[model samples]
Target: MGRPKYFTPNEVSLHSTLGDLWVSYLGKVYNLTPLVEEYKGDVLLKPIIECAGKDISHWFDPKTKDILTHVDPLSGCVKYYTPRGRFVHVPPPCPRTDWCNDFGRPWWKDNRYEVCSEETLDEILKRYLHYNSHAHSYTWKHNGVSLDMSKTLSENGIPDEDEEFFDARMDRDLFSLSICLYFNDDLTEF
Candidate 1:
């Protein structure tokens, strides 16, 4: 209901992961992370996973506001044209009594998943201090390299690649890029 948030393609690309997947469609950005959690390990998630953090406007029709359709050459039947392969919320090629539609609104149409902007390292540090009031001065580092407070994580050469680890079925915490925070003594504090 507030002002709509805007994000650059580069910023969106930073969230490409099962833990934080995002995609833009019809000029609207969506955080499909919940969908991934709900339908984890489903093959239908393959296409969506493959397109994480990228624009999926081509996956949808501009006018219909839905996935594009094509006539099947084999059966001459109309079906959702998913060149990337069928994904979640997309009904099967044929009617099935077992198909459940109780999910209410589909992920694409739900506005709750719409995303916003990001913050710089300095802003994040401020937030950290806000939560940890006992902290005085602080130093942020990635890969043992001191971070430039004015720059973002990506701008500082730290790419969020949790998705790659997830796709490889590896534990993220085991090999995740962690930002180390060193508490500095406030020499002037009185």
Candidate 2:
């Protein structure tokens, strides 16, 4: 089934089961059913399964979009603060030779698990149309790459620059970032 642009908390709660599990963190909902299927019977899945269909926003740092971490007093080392206990992807407190690090990236960092974001590219384009009537004829892109209209700006590697601009104390009109929009040749005038 195609994922929706938004999922209510109740809708997420409905999928809390071993066969199907979903979780939301840092304002993005993720369907982790495939992870469960892949790591079935693994002890690390206990914490994830226990909080299925629930929002785990508290588990992450909003700025970094990573697990919340703190310095371990005993070892004076920083570690992920998984109160529910360290699950998959999180390294053990003490290094263990048996521990695996072959996984390229953690599940949260993987886009495959993403189900929804705050706004989609389609919605953003519609908003642009309000200002420019011919916006529909232009293909959206970032860094010279075409964007997927079904995904959000962040998913397309378009970082929000408003904060950076504001930090520099530059007026929006004086320092504008350019987004090259090429009119689609296939678009026909009616």
Candidate 3:
């Protein structure tokens, strides 16, 4: 093996732009600039923009194992490439109480908050990779085909009620919303 590379936090901070964005996870650094164009309008884009040129080690808990792979010649880091681009689809409001509970009040409700446009599936995955490995339970693969929620509940040994509770609390749609009146400008106005 060759000698490992080293980068200071300041060095990482200098690269925080769409043209030269870099982020450090674990002990390695990845250049995310190549993904900038493809990730435009994605919910993950906001976090990526915020985290550009920073050591994201603090954002992730150290207990979690590395869920991403590292490729050589790419600075021994994994590139953020999602084959499906944005995976979470913001479905139209459903009448089911379960759905409403997971996504907060219905969009038509006066108290309903405006959803953040930048809460993409990739951002959720990044959070999962950093904080809770168990969140991976929401994903699985079978018979040469992969499914996102194949094991969301079963692997965790969670009861149906607990699963519903988890969905209600951590569901991407609800978690990313801001209590704002106008969906465009007033992201924080309640």
Tens digit of lDDT per residue, candidate 3, span 76-151?
A: 5544323223121223222344322353432212121111122223344455466644443443333333433323
Give the per-residue lDDT digits (tens) of candidate 1, residues 20-130.
999977656889998999999999999999999987876776667778899989889989899988888888888899878788887887889987644677666555566
**Comparing candidate 2 with candidate 3, which one achieves the higher TM-score?**
2
Which residue pairs overlap in candidate 3's backbone? Answer: 43-118, 43-120
Cα displacement (angstroms), candidate 1, residue 29, comes to 0.7
Top candidate when judged by lDDT against the true structure? 2
TM-scores for every predicted model? 0.57, 0.61, 0.33
Off by over 4 Å in 1: 1-4, 116-190
**Candidate 1 overall Cα lDDT vs. reference?**
0.78
Candidates arranged by lDDT, highest first: 2, 1, 3
Comparing candidate 1 with candidate 2, which one achieves the higher TM-score? Answer: 2
The most accurate candidate by TM-score is 2
TM-score of 3: 0.33
lDDT of 2 by residue, 33-146 (tens): 999998899899999998999877667765687898999999999899999988988888898999989988999899999988566877767767778777778887777999
Instruction: Report how far residue 3 has shifted in candidate 3, in Å.
Output: 5.0
**Preferred candidate (lDDT higher): 1 or 2:** 2
Better by lDDT, candidate 3 or 2: 2
C-alpha RMSD of each candidate structure in angstroms: 10.5, 10.0, 24.3
